[model samples]
Target: MLDWLYDIVGRILVWIHTGLTFIGFDTDSGWAWGLSIVLLTVLMRLLMVPLFVKQMNTQRKMQDIQPKIMKLRERYKHDKERLQRESMKLYQESGTNPIMGCLPLLLQMPVFFSLFSVLRSVAEGNARYGFDEELVESARAALIFEAPIAAQFNSSPEELLELGASDPIMAKVIIAIACVLMGTTTFLTMRQSIKRSISQMPDNPMMQTQKIMMYMAPLFGLFGLMMPVGVLVYWVTSNVWTMGQQHFLYRNQPVAGAAQTKNEGNGSAKGMLSRKKVAETTPEPKEQPKIERKQPKKQSRAKRTGGGSR
Candidate 1:
């Protein structure tokens, strides 16, 4: 089923490699393969942008409906099935699929495996996974600097030592640096994601999952040690792209909670300023004068009445 997919990805890589060769990058230089992988990463990420946008929109919708979800949860606390039904209904009504959040990442998985298969075939000096014989040979000879583009740290230490001897420490240094970079970028990307989530919904249950990812993501760099430096380069470039994409989304279309909070804050500030202006512009009320009544008025009226009677 996926053979076609592999062929497509392999052809793209071959095309990139060939283009670089024509541009003065030696067919045997690892830099050619490394840059090709980076280009591939960029292209894949660009293609996924629409899906990422949908994912962000779905996430925003989910956040917007969180209060409703909580109410449903409370109302159906004793009815698990009904709770789920109601939740699904709510999502349907809102045109949101929580699973959409994973769509972009899920789509990348096949591409990752395809690339891995292509690179592995190249490493084995085989024309499998859709590469022609000529392309295979070129890929086999491609060096990433001092190490072959297909070189894996899992290769025997003695073999690496020999390769290092030929390159004067360049191979080991490049692989180590690539691994560290891949790891650091992964960590930073996840951290930014978590930070954005927290800003939007500090009490979100999903934050626990994000927190766990924060600790686990950097460990992927360690896994990079077993992968080819070319693959590590791809991973690092993808991470960088994700970081930048996430930053842009967070800044522009922020999650519902964050957006609402910001709007409310602005409203509160405006209210305060208006109240202060009114206080400053309005005049104070004037004090009333005190009035004294005459005590002799009753006696004068009584004397006048007595003289009239006489």
Candidate 2:
């Protein structure tokens, strides 16, 4: 079942690639693969624009609530129950969910992995094996270059290894250059996004995580370069597209709650005092004790004895 599904998906992807190729996208050069990758990234990003908007809104709400949330923590200090209750109440009232911002990323992950698989197959010159009849014809027609990177990598593993070992210096140099571009583009894409996110954050744990990924993603990309240079070309172009899309979104919609803070001319003391007074005046009904006390009978005896003595 999985194989059948993959075949169907691969065929569909091939069709799309073929259609793209027919529409002047096929330049018959190594650049054709790169251009296809850019188109794929752009299409995926366009599809995700709605989700991105939602994510931005959620992020902004979270940012706006952060100060209040911090104040709530300080106010509830030792009261765990109160803290949980109030925090939930705040979320409910604000209609802000931190989880929403991550949903777009979750949704995009599978698509990303799928595209990687398809591109890898195509770049391996396995179009005939991976694509359907019509799509295969289209792919062949779309060949902008008679000698693509895929053709170079299409040799048997043993033959490929031999070539790599004894091939002319230029071939190795070309592959190395492709790998470098791939890694560099991936690193730059990741770095730009991380930098944007970091600039928005105020030295927090989230910022630390972003910083870690900024370094890690590039390292991962370097590993990715070990694959055929065709894959490298696809990856570099895709990363370039991603960088552009992110730049546009960041510039236009921008990330949530990342609006620059405007300084208030007046001191915030009045607002602080008002909130404090409101909390202070808010009455919390006292709880009565469970136990009851009885008066001693000795008091009555003492009263009678005193009367008799008098």
Candidate 3:
């Protein structure tokens, strides 16, 4: 079903490999091919810059409206039907849908999976999807340091021997380092998101999720043992890309509640006071009054201004 995506990924990989070879790099050099994988990540992310920016912007929008959501809940506490209607109206006016929050991630999955499939073909020497026998064999022989790009931390002894890793211990070490970098980069990425959330809403439950990811990043490293070194390289490089790209993009974009907490400074005030001030200060829009009164309009001018009009 995703063959179209696979073809695109495969073409890009083959293109990068041929470009390096044209620039005097050896066709079978693991350095060249491994570099191809890394460059593939960079190029792919570069292409998705818009989606990345939108994802961040969307999340920040979601954060920006948290106060409004709270207000809706409070105003309609006794009316479940009204609460749902007002919430939907608020989301519409804000140009936000809860489902849109997941749209960017949904769009990105096929691209990642397609890349994964292309790399799998390289490992198995399948030679389809823009790769010929020669290119596939060259990719199969490609080595990044001691471990073959196709090899993993848990690769069997026989597989290691076939991939040109004479010492099994060295292969594991190299993959371990990549895995460590993976975990570190993952933690850093989550930390960046957490810092943004903390700045916006220190007591947000979302912060709990961020903290959880920060703690689980190390376990992601352990899971890396099951991935091909090439895939590990892809994951690590992609994480690094996310860190850098988010830092760059978010630096220019305004944080959701920056003004409210501008002088708060590093959460030194401890949050409660500022949050209260925000809740108090954020006035509801004039168009959406809290309640409607029919009798007032029905009354004549004699009642409205306490005087009769001719």
Candidate 4:
């Protein structure tokens, strides 16, 4: 199913590699291919900038409305259906979809897997996806940091030898260093987010789960042992991008603005409820019938005098 995607990712990677070569980098150098991977990451991220911006906006909207969301949960604690309807209505009013904040990130998962597959295929000398024999030879022979781009710490010595790692220990050590870099970047990327999450909503239902996951998250670096140095480069570079992006986009947050939001329950929910109550209880004006009275006529006096005489 993802074969087409892998092909596309492969082509993009080699395209970047070719560009690097045109600029005088040795095509057969591992550093050239490593730089190619780095450029590919930058290009992909640039292309996804709009989606990332949308994701950032979506999360901001969610946080802005979170207080109301909590209140909804409280009010409809027993009526699951009511809670759901009201929640959807609230999201609609705010022009927000809490689910969207994660969609952009989730959409990126396929690209990662595809790139990993492409790099793995390169190690196996499969050139059909996006390379010719010459390119395959160049990439396989290329070494950056004294390790093939396809080096993996967990690969057996024979496997490393097959991948053209002249010194298996050196390759293993390089791969380990890349893994540590990936883990450290991953943790740093999560730090600001964890801090903001706790500050914005100390009582968030997910707070504990988030905290637990934040520490556990970096352990994913351990999995780097099984990945090619190429993919590790990509992962670390991507995390660095995320950190910069987050810092720029959320520079003014978790402080003055959040303090106001926390005190106001974000204002949207409370204000919405206030408006609804006012509309429901306020009476509409009804027009009353108009009345006009005129003085009695002189004829009434004559009529009273005639009756007295009779």
Task: Identify the candidate with maximal lDDT.
Answer: 4
Give per-residue CA lDDT, model 3, range 1-310, as digits (tens).
8888899888988999899999999999888988888899888788888876777766777777889988888899999999999988988888776776566557666767777788777777798889999888888787788888878788887887787777778888999999998888888888886787687676576678768878897788988887888888888888888888878877887674675566566676658778889999999768965696567447776878977856
Backbone clashes under 3 angstroms, per model? 2, 3, 1, 2
Error of 4 at 16 (Å): 0.7
Global CA lDDT computed for model 2: 0.60
The RMSD of every model to the true structure, in order and in angstroms, is: 6.2, 19.5, 19.5, 15.8
lDDT of each: 0.81, 0.60, 0.81, 0.84
Per-residue lDDT tens digits of candidate 4, residues 237-296? 999998887788677444446667676885878899999999999997799988888876
- TM-score computed on alpha carbons, candidate 1: 0.81
lDDT of 1 by residue, 1-310 (tens): 7778888988898888889999898876667878889999999999999999998888778877888999998999999999999999999999999888888889888988888777877777678766778777676666666676776876665555433325635677778788888888988988997787777567787788889989888788789878876677788889999999988877888666667898999999999999999999999889889898768545676576777464
Clashes (candidate 2): 3
Q: Which digits, one per residue and each the tens of the lDDT, describe model 2 over residues 1-310?
A: 2445446445545555566667776534334544555565566667877887787677667767888888888899899899989998999999987778788768656655555555446544455335644443333333212223432333454434442223434444555566667767877887887776565556445787777776767565456535554455546766776688778877886555444332232336667888999999999889988886887656676676777464
Candidate 3 vs 4: which has more lDDT: 4
Q: Model 4's lDDT to the true fold?
A: 0.84
TM-score for each candidate, following the candidate numbering: 0.81, 0.61, 0.77, 0.80
Best-to-worst ranking by TM-score: 1, 4, 3, 2
**Strongest candidate by TM-score:** 1
Off by over 4 Å in 4: 252-310
